[model samples]
Target: MPWEAWPEGGFPRFSEGEREARREKLAALMAENRVDRLVVYGTWGSGDAVHWLSGWPVSREAAAVWAPGEAAKLFVQYRNHVPTARRAVAPEVEVAWGGPWTAEAVGGELLRRGGSGQRVGVVGPLPAPAWNHLAAEVREVVDLTAGYTRLRLVKSPEEVAWLRKGAALTDRAVRGLEANLRPGVSEFELVDAIERAYVPYGGMTHIHYLSVTSPSAPDRCVPSQFPSPRRVRPGDVVTCELSAAYWGYPGQVLRTFVVGTELPTEVRELHRVVEDAFHAAIRALRPGLRAEELGHALEVVRRSGFALCDDLVHGFGGGYLPPVLGAEGFWTLAHASLELQPGMALVVQPNVVTPDERFGVQTGELVVLDHGGPEFVHRYPRGLRLVG
Candidate 1:
């Protein structure tokens, strides 16, 4: 089933006080930058900032304009959604039609809010046309992307609660996948089973990737992005890297399993290497740790004669946020070196790639850093599961 078929309430929301706190944070940054007004943008699929400030998501295109001293005015596409948006937002937020042309609509709203003499700040992904239009009407345009990333890196109490819930839903999905694991079942069937697992809890979408290989040809089989007609077989190594979202927040988890009996010796060794990297990086995931230090922990895999496929770790909020740990080449400089702090949520993915690019393993989990140490949000067994 499609995620749209699921109930709208599948995702929980932050309290009104939480939403106000976010606005105040942005407003403070605007003041520090000498920006007289702030314009936050959101699109159909990427509406984190708009949702952060207004407590309503933009299914199409939307913008929220804040003038520092007054309530924020939200402009969304389609007047029909105004009623729904109004119901989602706090009383202090004003919901209105941003018109089909978001750039023009937001531009006009900015002029009315602060006129042409005030400096304006932009955050999130704003269309170039809308950006140009707004630029013509403001005294100066400042990019608040970095400021927004810094602010969002640390989760509030409310955000942590939501993330925890998201993690629970993810755990349920993985269990559902495990329960349905057996020979003769097609990969697509397993995919459906995972998606169905979320509908009951109100999960919006199950973004996932699953692939399978025989023990003898672990390096020979190529994984499919989407499920194929091929059915599961005994001794096949099934690997999945999946995530499910609740109220726009998502938690990712990964697993590799043998369809029956034990894993091949080579596969077991690969998993061992990946697990070492996962543990080494997580041990450094504490309040005072630097982002680069956490990344350097992944160097263990290279020392073990294995390479990483992609990113090692990232800050997770409405979506992937700043201070990405792994980037460029795994051998090169790390992405960014920001300080780790309590209340930070992250996805620890230590994927191992063989030099031949055929055999690999992914062992990852959703984790939150507290003052004490790192806590696992989703804790499924780290080793390879044997499914019959």
Candidate 2:
């Protein structure tokens, strides 16, 4: 009951009904795909599928076995996390030790649940070694990653609640940046302050704070992980693409700030163009909208005489998922653009760089696609801010 003291009644926690609906959906997907048994496998870095189905945060490695008509069973790497896993997962889910022998543990459970000689499916990107182990016992190994991805494309009520909470913290980080940013303040100091602000919200700041500033050429913005001892001065531009994750769900925002009272005409124009493009993309977000149409929105930046720097939009759930927009020039996990659907969360980062790379404006917000248009999740002001 010690874990019960942690209080799971708030936004990030899910109800039993919500969790059951997810399991039922997974079972239906497996049946449709002719998959007799399905294993949702992942590590801490890629555990969204497992967490989505079982509600347990994977530390090192974990899996959830979905056998049709049987209660889903979760497997964790270490026995020590069993108690915590129990508290994290829904009541009906079964938990077992897995770790060094993950395949064996899951294999035994699947076979016991009528999976012997049945078609097996692996969801998400399971490491080949783990698959080899599972494949040794199970005869047919099918790639059901697409089926799982489709299932996760739409957010559940619980997922939306958690994402909104995470977005609130991301907005708080933006405000924290505004209050602490001043002349002579190192990027390191500002980042530290933002991290502290997330603590009250049960959020953790991403390790890399893209805090970069420019003084001479105030129009340019660049992402930097290594915060230097370099300090801000008057007439400087400070850009931060800050982010935070709450209960494993991540929310991120991009903001550009000027250090001086008078904003330069050149930088102001760049900001105006970027904001206009952002609004256009927002208007384009609706159910049934193809991903490529959203990608075409990137042309707005190019038409405004700016080069596209990042994806026009990217998917987000517990973290960045798939079906990225304007991903033609950038790296993406998806082969083609997917249709926009309600409950899908996105970070619309429309970045524009000058022909000379001397000036740019990058600003965005976490949003959820709705029946109408894009709904703002992180509600901080979208335009460039003048802060001293």
Candidate 3:
């Protein structure tokens, strides 16, 4: 599919073939592990597995049981959610209410499906109570979260198509927030602007973190996970890490903005270093590039006498897959030996802060790893934006 050919005004729907492909891959994984039944669990905060497998973005709590040649059964909590959950899943899936206790209901259903002597593979964040119940019923329960993450590492063409729409919506939100940047606007109002830009087009806000501070007497270094009531002031620096989603896929973009035309020398220098480090990672991105090799980009920040207040790189779009790295000596690295592959989405944000950790700037966005190099998902203009 062409990158920009998705429908304009509603949620993008995956084709039946797409759903079948995912099911096939998952079934193969279960067979390789010698599992007779697979239990996929999800909740409001963490539902990537349920969403990917059944097309339903989980609301409160949900679980599914799948075995070879048998139709998958999806159990959802809160009776009111059953209708929408039924509408969202495939026609073959059986959707039902889990009564008072969702975990116990799933456990009872599993036992009826001949789970007593079978090996079961589990995915998603199943609570301890639920895990204990399933373990007692089944012969053995295998944690398949790692294997599930690997399955999502490489997205399908349809997933990429949806990601493109997500990135476009994210760009719209950031630009909307940029246009509202001026003295006297509260951080909450800024978040309102961001949501207004995309919600009308069915976009959802995954995160809209903002950091407001005066460049001359900067107090905050990184974007706050929650927005404050603090109002913007003349000559203040507004740095943000925003993400807007289309369904479950989201695009992340980090940027720094100055509230006035006069850019502080230190802030300018800091952004320059950030841009350099961002592009350095871009130039080094390729299909076979090692995760640790991307650390070369951090060298630019370290050499410039600045350190990072946030992660420099991470796998994104499909549940923060792997290769979460930070500046050397600043944060611990993970998946250091993982290799980059085509179709993987990643964010290369380099939030460069002073050695004192009092001032910083944000820059970077989501990119897809290609054979040639990293393909930027967002079209938001790079560099320090000036407003007011």
Kindly report which residue pairs in candidate 3 clash with one another: none
Question: Between 2 and 3, whose lDDT is larger?
Answer: 3
Q: Give a tens-digit lDDT track for model 1, residues 22-59.
A: 87898789888989888888888774888888777677
TM-score of every prediction relative to native = 0.90, 0.88, 0.94
Tens-digit lDDT string for candidate 2 (1-388): 2112126653245787887787788888888889888888878777578888777768778888877677779999888988788777876788988856887888888778765588898886787877887777777888887777777777887788777777887888888888987888887888777887776667766543554556454444555666767677887787778777677776789878888898878778888878887888888889987776665577777788777666677787855665666525434435245777889888888777777776677888788888887888887877889886
Q: What are the candidates' C-alpha RMSDs?
A: 3.3, 3.5, 2.8
List candidate 3 segments past 4 Å from native. 1-11, 328-334
* Per-candidate clash tally: 1, 3, 0
TM-score of 1: 0.90
Positional deviation of residue 58's Cα in model 1 after best superposition, in angstroms: 3.0
TM-score, candidate 3, is: 0.94
In model 2, the clashing pairs are 219-359, 219-360, 220-359
Instruction: Name the better of 1 and 3 by lDDT.
Output: 3
Q: Runs in model 2 with CA error above 4 Å?
A: 1-12, 112-116, 206-208, 215-220, 225-229, 327-337, 356-359
Task: Tell me model 2's lDDT, rounded to 2 decimals.
Answer: 0.75
Candidate 3 lDDT, tens digit per residue, 1-388? 2223335533356898998898998998898899988999998878489888877778889999988788889999889999888877777789999889888888888899985898899999999988998899889999988888888887888888788888988998999899999999999999999988887776877888998999889899999988889999999999999888888789989999999879899998999999999989888889988788887888899899999988888888767668888765323343787888999999989999999999899899999887788888899998889887
Ranking under lDDT, best-scoring first? 3, 1, 2
Model 1 misplacement above 4 A: 1-11, 78-80, 218-225, 327-335
